[model samples]
Target: MLVSIDRRCIKLLQELEKETEFVSIKSLSESLDQTRRQTQYDIYKINSLFEFDKLPPIEAKQHKGVRLMDVHREWLKDLLDQENKKEDSEYNYVLTQEERCAVIICENVLRNGFSTLDDLSEQLMVSKNTIFIDMKIVREKLKEYNIECEFISGKGYLINGEELEKRKVFMYYISSIYGLISDGMLDYLQDEDVKRHIEVLHKIEEELEVHYNKGIIEKLALMLHFSETGENTKWNFPQKTGSALVCVNIDHVCRSHVYGIIDKYMKDRSDDEKAYICIHLLAGRMNKEYYLYNETEEIFEELAEKLVGYFETLVGVTMDKRGSLIEDLTQHLSRSSYRYIYGINDGSELETIIRREAEELFNVVRKVADRFSHDIQCPIDDQEVAYLAVHFSSHMHRTSAKKYRYSSMLICDESEKKRENLKKRIEDNIPLIQIHEVLTKAEYTEAEKNKYEVVISTEVLDINDGYVLISKKFDNTDHINILNEVLQSRADEVSSLSDDLFDQIKPYIQKKQVGTVRSIVDHFFGSDQNSTLTQLLTRERVKCLGDKDVSLSWRDAVFQAAYPLLADGSINRHYIDSIILNVELYGAYFYFDNGVYLTHAKDTSGVFRSGVSVMTIPRGINFPHNKKIYILFVLASVDEKEHFGVLKEILKVCDSKEKTEWLLEAQNEDVLYKNLRMIAEKK
Candidate 1:
């Protein structure tokens, strides 16, 4: 293991290890008592040692001095300890210029210790000019950590900030310079003490039947190593009171094991120590049952439900098993809160995937995080937001898979008993169709049939759409076979329609728009499909209603605005329900800067097709915060891609106050239609 390395190179290695920022060459020259060429030669020899030893190299900056990247401290310790036997070197290390400045400011300024610019230059073996440049770089980096670097005239330099921020900078630099093993760790742990502590931790793991991850192990070791040192540091425990409440409900056995270990290894343990240990246990354990603490259980549960509710509304999907989803999310956030508070980040690689695949969900999660942060009085970073997005996106994908199988409508005759029996039969025999609603004869409208693919009716219908007539006691395999056959035929028709004139217009329209275009083509050109957006736009599908306020509740308002589309079979009752629930859960998130609320849910289970319906409420309905919404547009799109043009068209009209006001106050449908055309032309 012996190697031929210069003593000065070893000295340089020790200096580089202590430096967080880059050091200048001129400073290194003065520190090492060597010429610039000699200093460069020493650095070269050190790089050779680093390469031979397979250790990370010392990296050099252009203007700033050479600094050690995130190098291995333990390896350097072994080398330095080995080198100690041969030489009595007073200049044991030569810190880079940047590292010297950080040390001078942090140790002297941060601690209120005295050191003038001349004193610092002399102590660090750097010229005053180099010290000035180093301090400038340190000032910029401190901003990222929210620490202020200030220098008062007679007072020299001072780290003026909150106590918590100061310690955060201290801890960060401590880690950066020395890696995980710090002076505190080495000083506290004897060879035997380390072995005894590891044994105790292992015993606790066996008792709890839980294994801690590498992160947890390192964190535990570090905490134990610096427990006494940390106590003396007089650090602020802002999260201590909150963390104690969170730990109140942990599993008794897990808590007991943690207590046993904490008592044995960490003497005179404080509340903060116990809470910190509890967080590590909760985060590192594989069992989800141990996620929640007792007192905060209900609080996290409710928060999880509210979050999922907002997510469902934003993503346009119904979340089943709300209880389970809530529990899981609560557990994660609870654990995450502790880490976020202490600035302990076990970074995620899936953050990019979550951001790219579910960008909208990520944005929604960020908003939720912001709101939640306001409630808890803690900042939620983008990484945490991405983590929540992944959870929501996975749940939505599962819910959508089941929903997409078959969205069906069940219609039976006047006989309640017969209708009930047929519903039961269909449920038992065919698993493909998801019956959205079961309607009686009086409530059933002919228009409703258009919303579904194949409707099972006890009475014979005159409808040309997918209609099936079954007997009263239709609980047979034959009925199932017939219903499935009808479904297959309807699917084939949809496929054919999708293929007809879609290829020509696919490039021009969005993926979600393809289905709407297909429907339009089927209506206009029959089997020979051809259609245009202008022709569709000219149709009275886009309505602008008048100011006579029909007094409606928020839920009722959503339905009323959406009723026109449902009546025409552009959307279904489920889409209407989704919009209402969306408004209920996530209030006015979709509202524009103007006095209009665009009520919409995309790719919800109930969107029969893509369409927009506009309704005006002159006597506006009061939203949650007394924000009056005068105009409401219920936008229903079955998929994500198709709605770009639709949204663009709507936004163009809504963007202008004059256009929007005129459209809302128009005397009649004809006037509104003409105004819409004019606005469309202007766009």
Candidate 2:
């Protein structure tokens, strides 16, 4: 018989097993950090489980405390050993409330029919009341993916949503709960089907000479298996024809291996089903080479370049290694575009923390993502936006000279691959600490003490000084903890420096000027150094080609708008030509969804100074896509940071229909300039 025991009860049994003689209830309560009454209740629960298994109950005397008989002691020892083994297999670890909620969601999503409350209770080893509470959490979580958990009088709990969304929820929660592909996941799928699907994926990897992220592979396998079994027949995926970039014939080896498994479970193969499988296969691929010949590669490349350029313009920093940044963005966009098309939300677990830690950078990247999404005609969610923020943040950190104040050492007993991955994650996210070495438990003990300022260990260490204990699979909480630790260390350094500087300067400064000096210092160190719209778009830079009797050509209008900046030496003639060249090559990407047409170029060689020239043409100039451009803004930037704030204000006006209309109605230079300045200064 199976027994459900809480961690407290298990600890109580372990304490009894360790003792040769009777132990006091008070000592046991202290050991488990619970009250004596709670300890007694735990003992009662353990005794009840033993009774069900027909084992001797613990012998408890009022004064002498509690003791298990010899037979009962052996029985507990064996049971604990089995439980430990089960924990090692990740099959029966005690579930936290969050994990329980995730499990409930997975169960509801994976099951073909409704899951009864009684069955869930039995499987999770909790009462129906606990399952009910878990269902509430499950419902809220499912709502994020637009899935609904519905309950009927006798039908139990079922997940209702679009098939794609349901699959996304299933993949996300299942991957979170299990961490990686494991035989333990067979509880959600048929054992034979899972094995077969995994076999097919392995074959595909071998044939393609590529590897997929393990979690992605598992999710893909499950999706493929489910699709093959006629479980995903409700919705039809659009068939994509003609591979533009197929370095390796996907139809030969890749299709054969995948179709072999699909054919066994499914007799008929439809083009829509094939397209579905191919889309997932491409999305799950980790190797960049696999996506080289992708049909949308050229489009993604152009989009990536524009995205990086736009990000640079927004964040006020030039990305280091521009080519590498473009390549990475292209790869991410390729996979993300597929996900966007299919409504698969593969967002990071650290999205909330990333947003909080890099709020300014996140906002900047969100603007970039918004532009990228507009270009592709897709809605990019915050999670994906957060991921793009990470890329830009990491790039910015790499470009800047970061001084590591503290040294860190990693102690992990995992394989070298996992240890290196953890090391990379730590270094990538937390730039304050430099990791000196990665040592195992034995290696750490043999080495010197106090060698590193921060000691991060996968397991508990016997060090006298403080150390951070993180899981082997480092999670978001661990990332935040380490980040806080490093940030606090940096803060301490800054605080000490501030104190010393204040002490040195206090005697020379007057009290009246102290506030002013302090404010200046704060602004110097803390400000982003972005220039406002009015600061850049002065009266000299504003121009109006008032309702030309003969409407200028789009090219002439671009040159006419840029002439003011060129005349004032804010920009050279080359800058204007570059803007024209961009339009010639990219076909008016500078055009916004609003009537405002923003013209700029990344080629700063022709830019002499940072300034903006706003020109209004009441007689709109026709452009490609039949877009009539009434208001033209020529931006000349010499530095990355100075133009960001003004660009943000301009984008704000572009976002508001009323603001755009206000600018369009202005007839002369003064009216256009005044209305534009009013709109720019509104916020």
Estimated TM-score for each candidate: 0.33, 0.49
Per-residue lDDT of 1-683 in model 2, one digit per residue for the tens? Answer: 23445555666777788888889987887665554545765776788777877887899887699988988877766765765455542213457676788677665674567888899999987889998988887887676556678888898887777565565566555655553125342254446776676776676656666565445556666665554235345543322433222232334423544545544443454544544455555544324433334554587788789999877654444776688667767766765565554534433444555554555566567767766665554446666776677556545532122332358899999999999989976765454456889988888863544777678889789875437888876654576577656545544555555566666877788999887776554444332233377788878777777654335788898888888888988888888898888777655665665667877887789888888888777777787656788778888776665555456567655654446777778767778888877665542
lDDT per residue, candidate 1, 1-683, as tens digits?
54555455666667667778888876776565444544676776677767876887677777687887665566677656654554653323456554564465345423544446787688676788888788777776565556667777896656555544454344334333332133321222335555565666666667667655333354354435433333434434543244432422333433555666665655555544554455555443324444334344566667677778666554444664566567668766665554445444343333444443344456557656655654544445565676676455434433211233355667775566766667755654344445677886667787787787667767666767566667665533334444445535544765665575677777998877877876676655332222122323433555444344455577777777788788888778877886777666667776654677777874467777677776666667777645578778767776553453354356545654555777777766676667766655541
Worst 10 residues of 2 by lDDT: 241-250
Q: How many clashes does each candidate structure show, in the order listed?
A: 7, 1
Question: Each candidate's lDDT (Cα)?
Answer: 0.57, 0.65
Pull out the clashing pairs in model 1.
23-65, 23-97, 24-65, 249-293, 249-294, 512-642, 513-642
